[model samples]
Target: MPPAKKETRPSSRAGRLRAPAFVKNHRGVKNWKEAGAWLEWRGIEDIECITPDQAGIARGKMMPSKKFTSNTSLALPSAVFMTTISGGYPEDGNGFSYPEDDGDLKLMPDLGTLSEVPWETDPTAQVICDLVHQDGRSVEFTPRNVLKRVLAAYSERGWRPVVAPEIEFYLVRKNPDPDYPLTPPVGRSGRPIGGGAGYSIAGVNEFDELIDDIYHFSEAQGLEIDTLIHEEGAGQLEINLRHGDPVELADQVFMFKRTIREAALKHETYATFMAKPMQGQPGSAMHIHQSVIDTRTGRNLFTNEDGSESAAFLHFIGGMQKHVPNALVMFAPYVNSYRRLTQAASAPVNTKWGYDNRTTAFRVPRSDPAARRVENRIPSSDANPYLALAASLACGLVGIDKKVKPDQPIGTTANEDEIDLPRGLLEAVDLFENDKDLRAVIGDPFVTTYAAIKRAEFETFMEVISPWEREYLLLNV
Candidate 1:
């Protein structure tokens, strides 16, 4: 998971509770003007203005509440979006370019996301920032703007995309050193996590205190976690969020990761969203359940009035089969991300669509016509929520636009089929750069920057000599 960049001292023990932000006859703050009043009502002493950078890391300014409410000019470097996961800039090459002076981008608050930083020592408010040029144009390179661009594509066609993300993660003992391996945290039994405890009610009880804190933190943030389950891995857990508008859902996932990590810290265990945190355990995935709806009718576009599958549904599947490989880099964004995509890793290796098959990349669950949708199981828990959703929806929309038809649904395990997706970071990056259909939907410049950053990250990873190299190859060679 992305670590929080800015730190605020606890409002009360790292925000175990929320302030009385509610007012008489209260609803939510619908606009910036209303947000100002809500912040004041909450008696916010500090403000943490933030935006998701390319790696989904929180990036932005922190200031006094008065300055924030006064409409202060909050600006960040445009190049902030050009950073790699490691926080270093890539060398200029391979069609990638950066600004000469790193010009400032104005921060426009997405008032709907403004909320209290419950854990801060002083009453603090946090708001997600949207970037814009000083000249009044949206900063297309930013991750949030990238998702907005894709959502606008659906809006133009009078369609809205809905997504529910099932984010899988792990709880492990603290390993401060990077070279050491991770182990499951000792539970209430005082033993390392036992394996094969999938969906065991008793398994969750092992971390009851921690789980309760997670629920508390999420509740304070108004993040509705639909269900929590002990997953197949030793220390793995999954949280499913209720479905809604793609952008809104993405914001919740972005914030939920932070909440999980904080709760873990408070419990003295570490929560990691790394695609494959431990070597032997199943890799983490963020499976997105998605459907398209007619904005005017408020009906699912995947099904007909007669409750049969629609042509748009097949086209969406066909689009994913044809286009998902090119977009895989967004789903598996890091060097570690590919480790989870391998065969037998409890992950999909191909873009085959299947009817409720766990092995296929796209699984169409058996549901009523109204709930008909496809689940994109390719994204790792580590992917930028905005980019992952944007890429997934963009592929489906392109399929709908081109009238593409899908191959026959697979009945058996499709992971046994060819490994259709890119198997490594650099390979996926190359595919992403060459995909014009995806580039046309996701801004071309943004795609270019993304691919270059991935290349730089891969190069950095290659520089490291893993212990395995010395264990096996060094002496043998």
Candidate 2:
């Protein structure tokens, strides 16, 4: 029999918020008139106001250039916050009531995120937004809002968190069949990539056109992408971004995903940030390098004036070691994400910190005292950048506040007896739901909502039958 046909659900726009009649037609120049003038001067015709959903997907509406820049805020359905990764509403079944049923929330644009859409056929611009309720309260479940809350916590302590992300992804041929494995796209050499090519310069040149376009798009979007290298898996590549504010880096990473995918499509290839896209190959990861800076004197809080490691540094690592098990849901968000955390995949399965060691989840890279930082190697490329950064920073802040001291750093692979992180989505979700301190730090409302959504997704996924079950269990069991 032929494979089952996939569901033809309407695009998310069906459930999206509709503009009020007054604002829909009346596009009078107003609060952000200067922004409108600038877009008009640049010949931009449309603007996309984007919000990061719970699943890290960008959702929003495009408006005429004038309307977008003139309006102080864009309103969206409150239900947007409650959307599950599968694009389904909550299945609790008692009426499906949520904030959107009552009203809509305004999306306030972050002016700093304004950028031209270099890949679009038309003259278009895009900006990231933060969701705000009608009464001016921030929406807690939105990934961006969660990150902002974490940043605010750091601010209260008179410190700023800097983050740099090393993103890895794959370039695969477009495969429409669900049962077939994806193959690498044909490069300029007229051959599909095979086997490992870690750090191979020839492997990079094989698809220089795609790389060049990615660089152009990154520059246009103001993304601080520093280096690109071939990774261990075929058609896999990693790009490192320059470290800066946590929120800014998250925004850049979010935009970078869109940029890379668009460039790939233009070249008739596909780009995926999926945690484990192929079997028997190393998985992609979004490794984050983080550090804290004192607001008063601009000194590295992780290091002392004499260039020795400070107590704060130890506390930061201690906090990560303490909280990472519970925060695993944020780092490895999906079921496929757990598949990438195995021993042979070169992914960290335990929260062990060490100096310049990739085997440990957290590694303190060799750098000058001024550049002291911790590299969180647990998050998968599929993880939401905002939530991952927020969880990491929040845990480190907890360490700083509690003065948690870390154990001795390991110089090699962590012992098999070290603390193991959550093995799968169910365990991670249960841990996240029950961790009171983490819920408080990230926000109780978001924790509750996110847990519900993930649980629903897990249930839905469990219902689907896989080829392995049919091939092995069908004949025997």
Candidate 3:
């Protein structure tokens, strides 16, 4: 029998006390333009905010064939979406249009595709849309479409990929006081909740209400949450999702993040997937487990006669090892991401694999032949699930095409040979940029776009003079 459940109550934090103004507004799509204007008045630079009508068009939900009036500004990418919502563009049509607005076009909602955000107050509501052009050409550069294309590749071959993820993150205090350096805050008792609890079930239960709220939020938002467990680090936790198709899995991960943020805010806590939020403490990771099945026969492709990995499984492993180095940027995208891939401590710092060995870059859980699959433990919490999944599958396909055979296992740290991994985001990007085969696999657009984003992030980090530099250099100079 299960243990007796404890009494739980809603958080009484300041966030819950103050009602957010936008919660009850029911004005049709018009509210979006107003929200945009409101943001713009506050000096928000990303002027791309949408009107409800434009949102309808993007979601292809319900576009009235009549034009609506609103002189609202939005960010460039957001504005592109707004154009679709306003019936000034086709939902799936492509060709970039900005700064040129033709007068009076009907907006229509397309129901063919839609994604839901679990953190939204309205759980039943959907964040719907499709790429569109004024000239009726669907934009190919949209990130959502990229994942769709990759998922389609597997679907076409009747191979349905099931994926689940364990997203680990830290909860830090939002310190706005200029007097203090940014750090995790103490509870009312003067003891910090973020300090030292390694995989303690009792520790997680101590915050039972918070976890319950998170589970409720997930269920309301349609996320298939399997369990929430305490992680090895202080103030860190892991939320695992039930395995599903690759596309659904990625969507679940993206939605789960927002849910965490919203729930944290209500509790006066800050949640982050920043990979390494604190120095010395264990960092967060986003380990993904994946398996493929034949759609028609419902057969697990990784299984063998002896209930072991098939040749196809071995080939997939080979592809992952071959491309992991080049694809490191996608798995570890941010500057702080590299800090998480240290040797041992359950983090993989080398390009290697082993059965049930968490120390290696990849792990094949000991399973019956019918349930075989690969568990990639390299990606930190900062990884973009869509990009990560796409790159991983691309590598697997390459291995299959080349019939690449994996070498013997790398074993433990004692027997593991010295292997190198990127020490920083720039080095990872450099590795990615120089890899011709990986570039061909992921396409030029993805590689270029990823490099540009990562490069910009690195530059931002460089401009900031850290506290360590000030403490050491200011006194010496």
Candidate 4:
């Protein structure tokens, strides 16, 4: 792949945002006017102005193309940021939460993210929106804004973070009942997918039609797919996105999730991003590959003048090691997330860095100095991409700021059973709320709001009695 070129917002077009390379490739568009022309040319009827909530779910209003083009005012209650995964609001008041009066926040469309909703028959377009107060103040609690804040810190230091995310998910049979366990969807052979097939070409071909739709949808939206492969678990697939600007890549991830699920529904199946969707199968993960680059020269900062590992590189890893545990709640957000963190699930159990060792949480993949990068394997598939990237980058940035040094890299034979991460959602949230270093970078309000939201979710989960509890403890205890 060629190096990403620096993009400058069009000077001639007032209020134009800088479109990333992928968005720039669409219809030769580089600004809102050009994007608008493309929309008109395509005969778009409706525009979905949306923003990601804490759980990465799209929330906002949908309006007609005329209203969207005319820039009609759109507002959503700030309480949406405080919404739990179960769609419940937390009133525990663990910390100062948003919407004290349930006031509205303005939704400002990010024109660079405008693209056609390929699944819609009415020729609809969707664009990610950013939240702001009525007085034009930025809403710091929004997930996208959290990532933007972290990126701004790197920008101030003349550094830019590049990331490529590999998303793993399962193609499962439709199971509407919450009581029933999910099963792998029947493939072309009309049999339930059995066992792990890991990288077999035949395995991928079993659902060739769905994969093709993914490619088609991705291409239509200008979302670049770096690679696609069959993962270890039955009916599991992983799609790797091309490395690029962190914010733009996050937007792509946010969009890709919706696209994949819509595509799956078209095939009469379900695409689930739950970390542990099915029992006795390898869980899904969202492993992020990241590197820092000098903004001016566009040179990879992880490498030194003599082609050896640079201090900045080690400091980044040191940052991840020091802060990741406290920030684990962001990487593994749900109650079910911890179930996938066990060593037996092929997920990293410790925050140990290793050179090309998959067993470790942070793997420095062997590459040329320019391509040197770290694969953070800790994040689960269910995490919000915006917060996950922000937390990881914030950790590395704080490490560089403090000149923290990492422990010696572990080798392939190191102990694989080290259990260092938070054991459950409650513990993870506890760590998240109290980490001062993380609060300094990710901001204090976000920590408090996020922690309260997670606590509410944990409380909700505690209300349910699981099958295991009924079967094991009903009579024995």
Candidate 5:
């Protein structure tokens, strides 16, 4: 099937938000403006306006807008960007344990479900609300809101950033098959597990029935899926979402991940976004493609008028390079994420942009003056969409503002002058800790907390002994 057309917000002259086909498909949203209003009424605030610059500075982190307020105390600021969905218990609270977790208080509401009034008994109602602190301050950790704020900066420049993500994940064999209780390690791979072949599109055809269901469910959930194909692993698949604006596109990415997992469970399968779920198999990756458009004239800012060096394009690449190190934490947040940054297999180990080069950290497809743009190949599928997009934009915008210029494009590989991305989560944490530019862009509080969280996670992993240890050490010792 041909891909759908790109959806844009209604022309400012129209004086109403443009309803995309997917959104309009929702029962009775006759007018787009009303839908935007509906979101406002449900406590959905625009990221740019709602994100507390003061709070962000206080948090000292990038994308602090995703944080939520504390439920127990209401005296604090109620305004926040990211919404939280309470599921029986509030996350990170004293009551989150046994009985306190089953409380009735909800932080924020999902705007998509606004048409259904008084959503008391709706089993599907996630009680998903904005993240706010007890001080009524917005939650800084919310990933969705972070991207929203970053997109706003571009919008103010009369440019719209179109973004698409190729998300790869594993559909692993459920260790203890639920249906066949006695059978151990027996999994219905729709064909057979570890059946020799790799990148077998036809092999995955056997699982099309379930995969198709995933596509349809995504459609129903207002997700824009462009393609789905079997990956190199035994039970791996990739789903790509059609790109749009950074904020909207990032939100779609998040929803897509949620939908894929939820839909997979219905078929009694386990879906994982882990960067490297199995050894000796191709890992999952999230390849991001991006382009920019002028908000006023609807012109693509990345394109050049006379096929000359476009200031915007150069500055954008410069921004990406300048902040690549600091953005590592956002791109490869988890320890496992670093495992995917190999030299070959279309994964980038160094920071550089090349024309139509898959090996480069960034790829600018050689296109006509009309459709020129860049692709960032660093991020993994498990990356928080909000943080990834926000960090990229923050870096790119900084380059533009500073008029930073990049050297001759490095195609496929890095040179002596080129810098490498942080090789591991530990190194990434260290870079993030001392990076003044990134700290200035995002803030201190968030960086400190994020580093702390990641350090804690690393420490926890260190305490665990894996099969690799047993296999190598048990026999020799």
Candidate 6:
């Protein structure tokens, strides 16, 4: 039998009692004029307009409050969306290249994503933007736009996806040298963490100050963060956000990552969301829990009125099982991401589904009929949250539309003989590039661009000689 569900506490202790009036009313500063006015009202002097690049990293300009609203839109080069994770152009030219010269694109503020930069020393604010072509259509390669495209598909089907993300990361002592291994930061007790402390209240208290600041910053940014717990890795923690619209949840996850990094810096530590940052430790992941609801009745589409599992639910699982192998590039994009997927690493390595089974890629958590959902455990923390959420939802939609039926759910344990996931970035990229159905749903342009970027990153990684190679192969071989 599946483990019994436990009542979880709200993650934001500060916002749990009651939220401030300003926070309640702040539904993202809606337009250029409204954003400017909100910044002015908050005594903010600088405003940063950011858009997620192909790698999910924020790239944008910081503008003076006075000059920002004067222009209707921010113009940037189209090439910005095609840059590799290492800040270099792809070997085979970015597909968006113009014959004459680099083309220009526009940045339109997504007013719903405006939030104050709580960790900044100066009065500053930031808003996420949507990349738009000169023709006024959204840029196909942008991570945010990709998510919007998938969400639009759901809307056309009279369905909406609700998503909640569980983000895991580690706090370590600040280290500038790439050669040195990271150590857990010294907590309030002035002792560095020595081993894994999953679910230990004492572990949480040790880093109370940093965790507290994270809560405050999350509250200020209006991120609906809900539960906090110590994960299985030393100094690792997980934050759970309440479920809501897929787009809104993606935006919140994007901001929440930046917030945690900034807060860690302020507390004299460093935070890394890398999938596997340390040897002999569990890796961090961005586990996405998802459900769909009817647009008209707002009823849970995964559950039937008779309280049994719905066909839509099983078909959704089937879709994920069939399509996840092709979408592996989005879930584990980096060279380091695959290191976390090893057996016994608390990461899923196959597209098996089970009832509350942690070893499976898809797990159906025990919940009430209305809350029935699927938890995709494949994506790592290093993944671009926008792309990951979009891909996951798109797969489920494909299953529902085609009426795909999943095989019987694994009871307790996943089959050891099940097929393994792509072993590395190269394999995953190949799978993504070759999959026709996945490309159709996630856009051909995005699939091509993303695969190129990951290929470039993988090639760069291949050129490096690690210490392990020198230690083992140099003398012996």
Q: Answer with 3 or 4, whichever has the higher TM-score.
A: 4
Q: Which one wins on lDDT?
A: 4
List candidate 6 stretches off by more than 4 Å: 1-27, 31-33, 93-100, 415-419
C-alpha-based local distance difference test score of model 2: 0.83
Return the candidate ranking by TM-score, descending.
1, 4, 6, 2, 3, 5
Tens digits of per-residue lDDT for model 4, 6-73:
23344443424433344434423545555555565566789888999999999989887666766468
Q: Rank the candidates by lDDT, best first.
A: 4, 1, 2, 6, 3, 5
Q: Candidate 1, TM-score vs. the true structure?
A: 0.94
Best by TM-score: 1
lDDT of 3 by residue, 1-477 (tens): 111122222245653345344322321123443333322222222211111221111122321111111331111243333332112432221222332553222222222112223444432244324444445444333444456666666777788777788899876788656345446644444566665677788667655666777887777555677888878676688988888777667756766776787787777787788788777888888888878888887888877656766888888889888878788887887777887766555677776788887777778888777778888888888777777777677677667667888877766661244555777888888888887766665666545555655565566668778788998999898
For model 5 the local lDDT of residue 226 reads: 86
lDDT of 1 at 393: 97
Query: What's the TM for model 4?
Result: 0.93
The residue-by-residue lDDT of candidate 6 on 1-477, one tens digit each, is: 111222222346663444333333444844454554466556678888898787678889898766666644587787777677777766565342332566887888777888888888898888888888888887887899999999998899899899999999999999999999888888888888866699889988988888889999988887877899998888999999999988888888888889899889998899999999989888999999999999888899999988899999999999999888889889988999989988655898878899989888999999999999999999999999999999999899889988888988887666354457898888888888877777777897887777777877888888889999999999998
lDDT of 6: 0.83
Candidate-wise lDDT, in order: 0.86, 0.83, 0.62, 0.87, 0.59, 0.83
lDDT comparison, 4 vs 5, better candidate? 4
Residue 245 of model 4 has an lDDT of: 89
Model 5, 295-336: lDDT tens digits are 776777876667665798899898888787777888887778
Q: Which stretches of candidate 1 lie over 4 Å from their true place?
A: 1-28
Give the C-alpha lDDT of model 5.
0.59
